[model samples]
Target: MRLERTRREPEAGMAVRTQLPAPPAWMRWLPALFVAALLLVEPFTPVDWPVSFALITVPLLAAFTQGPLGVAAVTVFAVLFEGVLAGTPCCAGRSVGYLWERHYVASYVCTILVGAIGTVLAAHRTRRERTLADVRFVAEIAQRVLLRPVPHRIGNLLLESLYLSAAAEARIGGDLYEAVPTSYGVRLLIGDVRGKGLLAVETAATLLGAFREAAHDEPDLPSLADRVEVSMGRRAMLLGGGEVGERFVTAVFAEIPTEGHLVRIVNCGHPPPLLIRSDEVSELDRGRSAPPLNLGVLVGEPYSVDVYDFRPGDQLLLYTDGITETRDPHGVFYPLLERLRSWGPLPPRELLEQLHGDLMAYSHNGLQDDIAALTACLLADQPAEPAPPSDGAGGSSGAP
Candidate 1:
């Protein structure tokens, strides 16, 4: 007769809490110290079963609280303690022969085996931990090098820039801004690439690479924009896409002339940049509407750039739609125009910081997308000349 067997449910493992419970510093050290003490007493006295059992606690504690480093250290402490406590002098008439050959050989082997396993386990754990740390370090380096910190000054333009990448897990969606002085004027670009991750980064890089080159040669913003579109189209062909099929980049380029009072602003399906004055803020509206760069379906001519009157003491704030499109829980969007209205009279950097802080506080420190802000404030007047060429002399410019 065959007997029926019953199936049993597997026991659930303990759930790791998001918040790590940090034990007291002294208390954390206690178990390892205790193991060290036992190892010290292990060999001098007759080998006790209790002592080997006690060794288990050190590693278990280290494994939980101190991690791999602590485990390895505890193992070393055990080895040294064992060597000092138990190893006999291999000298004639000093019990060396008896101790080495007969009296404690089996016990010594058993004691060593347990400690050796702990040490090896600890070492393996340490190596694995180090590998993880190295991976994280490399990722952080890539992010730093890829998204370099844009200096506060680009060519003749005094820039105050702010960039905030969403949480690390989000992999940073593409929101890009750059200011470079060309033969034409101080050319500034603010763009948000279609989609995210590697694809978005590739599109952003392609657009900027083309812009930087074209901005110097194209002279007109439309030509530069066309160049960007062509470059983006080429990349989409090479990379193939889900986002490229459904998404497109919105961009705005500004060319600020040193001698002129007017600044050319090109809005290529991009959100209009806000102009902040002493009392009010207004969007730099476009006269001719156009599609975003790299729609691919239709290749169009260059759109005309709008000229804006920017007097001294005026500030231009350029940003991606992330700032304006951020929705609160109540379906209310953050109004950049209104915020700038109340938060004007602030210097460029300070104003951007204030906006950043308010956004964070309002969103409970959670951002769903990348944010890039570029503020250029026109100074009332050029103040004074530098003493000489000491370093990169910039003691005379910027707005108050």
Candidate 2:
């Protein structure tokens, strides 16, 4: 597998296209079609019955799909066409000079008034759409920076991640994950902040930043967790309020050492990671737990790391509670463990893809909360990479 960075072309150098979303071709031409239909039937209709009066609806139709300028142009055309239909001798059996009649003139004035109103509505609609587009653009950029993609392969491990926000338009949320190659091992972190909104985003960012830095410096998983805890505590202190104090992040940290079949994990008030081996799946519960980040002082529990044998073909799955908590129409929670046991073994990416599809189907696309999951598999029979040479002090150091 290969890691690829996607680069977007600079918008400054690109030509500006109409900001309005594309609708059907027939819909955009509906106003013109309405005018044509009126002209065709006007000649056949009686003098007492005038079909051209319906031209007032032309501008309204255009306003739905066209910009202000387009709507105004259509409005003007409709008024002029109404006059033509009124004056044509064959149309509605009217005389040539009927265009200047009091009723025809009234029809022209009313069409103009309606057109003006439609133009104003179109302008307001366009502005609101543009503002929404800008907001979504900014949100997308933030997501890329905060939840950067994990490298497909780190050491002998293959990794994949999936994230979904409960909100329809939201691209990022409190759920977060990251993987980094450290001198100690291939360290991975996945976690979820307690609540939603800006505060939750801030908390997730702080924890990810702390993990990235501490993963390289801290040699053991417990020390790494401690460093992260200290960072979270400092951040909570800076916020300085009771609401901020209520904020806590549930996380699991895993380290696959440079040369070993054993994997170490430190779970802190988070769901246990899944161990998938062949046809059997089991939870990697450490039997005891550490308090979540920001809750160390309140829970006052010391952190501990659990070691488990991770064979070459075994896969590890880390996720937040959102996955299992998703409910169907019957209010039954999704059975993730049971489903995994029934499925055949697949690659990390394909496995997550299937899981994502199943979750969406289970919830009928009505997700109640943010979801995040990361899966990593040890490549079968691949030899571990050689560790970097140690310095004179007997400590190994190199780029992660």
Candidate 3:
């Protein structure tokens, strides 16, 4: 894979992203070579080179950083060096008695055997690490494909999204949002799984997977909501006793009709999404909502849907609390909607960037939690382009 050098960044760029060049291969093998050299200098298998305290230091440090492969390489080099120098006339063959002595030969030979076992152990661990990396990479790629970039347009609305995980190493976390055009309307979902790591991500994946399936099958937003809850309940029941592990997500699901006429909203204990239209910004009416999904908690018959008329150019902003909950220098809560109302009518990408900048500034370049933003705007319809000239000479005389 090709690696790109980072020259500039929107905000703080971690220095680790620009690590120095790796140490030379010979340097990697130096410890092994040095161990082999000990047989000649000590004439004993377990020769204690006070300097070889590096044996523990080097392998552990190398293993911690470069891992088992690096340690294995060093081990191999040591074995090869020992083999070349082993039993090679320590006294210049002055006599057969001295040359054939068991003490002289077997010491290095047994040392070689021990070194061989060590190499085998190190190599095995190295292979396991490579396998883990491959698996993690595949999982990472799957997360990206499943949650591809939010489309620029959804139905009659223009869509923009902002997403950032807590790490450069991970592409996803417990936070997810998606907007898609379906027969029912343009459907959108913004959700946050309970935790901060892989298990939480797995829960989110479960929700999205279930949503995709049920979205197509269920007739209305309420029915679709029930289907999701049912799926989560089934998952919980699968693990023996009853309810699953402690997990929950606050979410908002909305549907915008094809011509941007009506917007349907359903809340599931998630952070209230902001509706910005005509210079007014406020959290959509919460009224009374059920507990988040997967907690074995749900309520209401129809799970009431809040419907609003969405005109062209109106915007819907979906976000996790990470942005709103961000604390400032004196620990005052960030005022997200107030600031958003102040900076009215920003396009989706600019809206996200501006909010991200504000969050960074509020925290003074430190964020205690992850931030994800998805914005959808209903744009006025576009006129179709006129049909092309029938003979290519309508605008200008033939060739002139």
Candidate 4:
């Protein structure tokens, strides 16, 4: 009997305005501090030397953190303060009669000119910042749609996902992941496209759409992988034009049975998933390698499914090459396996949080490639003498 798949309504949430945040408090007050410091020091300077001229820098400094109006206000204050210092008899022994001296007039005029220039700079900076913020906001929305957030719980499996783009301002890239709970089991997909930019992102979307739909319709893991491969081939041919060979995806597809102690995985030129059992980590490398999606046409190799023990309390991590290829200042690659060994057992969410922080620190917050990672930990126990439940005809409920 085929189970009717229900369509899920698109998630709706508050559309936050991700505008640039206000400047830091200290930065905002820096111009004020500069004026105060000049006021405090002018009294000690020689009578022949006047430090009030330095007030011109105050408006310039304000340009960095304030809008044009604020900069203009600072400029006016600076011009007025200059007159006060020049006429003050107690400071620098200057007389009130000389407040509007020709030199002081020139200083005021020059300060006004500098302030005008600073105001223009502040306006330009403000416009560019707003434009950048708008671009980022759109990128964030695209990320939500392309790489939708993975649910923390899927059946008896607890999942956590993390993605980082090489471009600092980018939220979505070639890296992609998706998890869907189907009659077959909880199916997961993670992959990275070969190249970068819009083409890579489009390819990733194609693979994700194919996986999400096929995971439910295809009964078996290998068959599902085959469907995805075919979809990728078509997408690449359409997008690549004459360069179809350049478009390929390194991916890993996994299925955890709804009632079993094993997981089936099909890796297509992707880094093998890591299995963590009782403080020990090992790679689930298949003896025979399979070509990446879209390359099957050229390589003419069949996809292979490998079954591995994934009982309750076991955690499996699937990641892209970006995590392993990260390099430090010393030119040494990140040691993922070595690092996982050192950490104690943690929940999937905490484990990924630690990995993200550690990876950023190891690379000094500099990543040269897009990264995607998914961790799944089994949370339910298998019944003793477990057997696949029958659907109706006494046949096993599990997919062939």
Instruction: Highest TM-score: give the candidate number.
Output: 4
Q: Rank the candidates by TM-score, best first.
A: 4, 2, 1, 3
The lDDT for every candidate, in the order shown, is 0.67, 0.85, 0.66, 0.85
Once model 2 is optimally superposed onto the true structure by TM-score, how far is the C-alpha of residue 195 displaced, in angstroms? 1.4
Runs off by more than 4 Å, candidate 3: 1-139, 240-245, 295-300, 384-400
Candidate 4: regions farther than 4 A off:
1-11, 95-97, 382-400
Model 1, 286-347: lDDT tens digits are 55756788773484556778999988878888999878877777767887787777765788
Comparing 2 with 4 on TM-score, the higher-scoring candidate is 4
lDDT of 3 by residue, 59-132 (tens): 43344334445555654554344344433434223222222345434544554455555555666656765665
Q: Candidate 1 versus the native: TM-score?
A: 0.66
- Tens-place lDDT per residue, model 4, 86-192, is 87788876554358888888899999999999999999989988997898889777777888778878877888888777786777789888899999899999898
RMSD of 2: 8.3
Give the Cα error of residue 204 in candidate 3, in Å. 0.6
Clashing pairs in 1: none
TM per candidate: 0.66, 0.83, 0.62, 0.90
Which prediction has more favorable TM-score, 2 or 3? 2
TM-score of 2: 0.83
Q: For candidate 2, write residues 1-400 as lDDT tens digits.
A: 1111222335523423324456799998888898888878877888877778899899899988888999899998999888887777766665554778888898999999999999998898788878866776677677777888777888789999888878866767899999999888899899999999999999999999999999999989889999999999999889987786788999999998878898899999899999999968999995777888888888777788899999998999999999999999999999999989988688898898888888888998888988899899998766579987768666756649
* lDDT for residue 365 in candidate 2, whole number 0-100: 89
Clashing pairs in 4: none
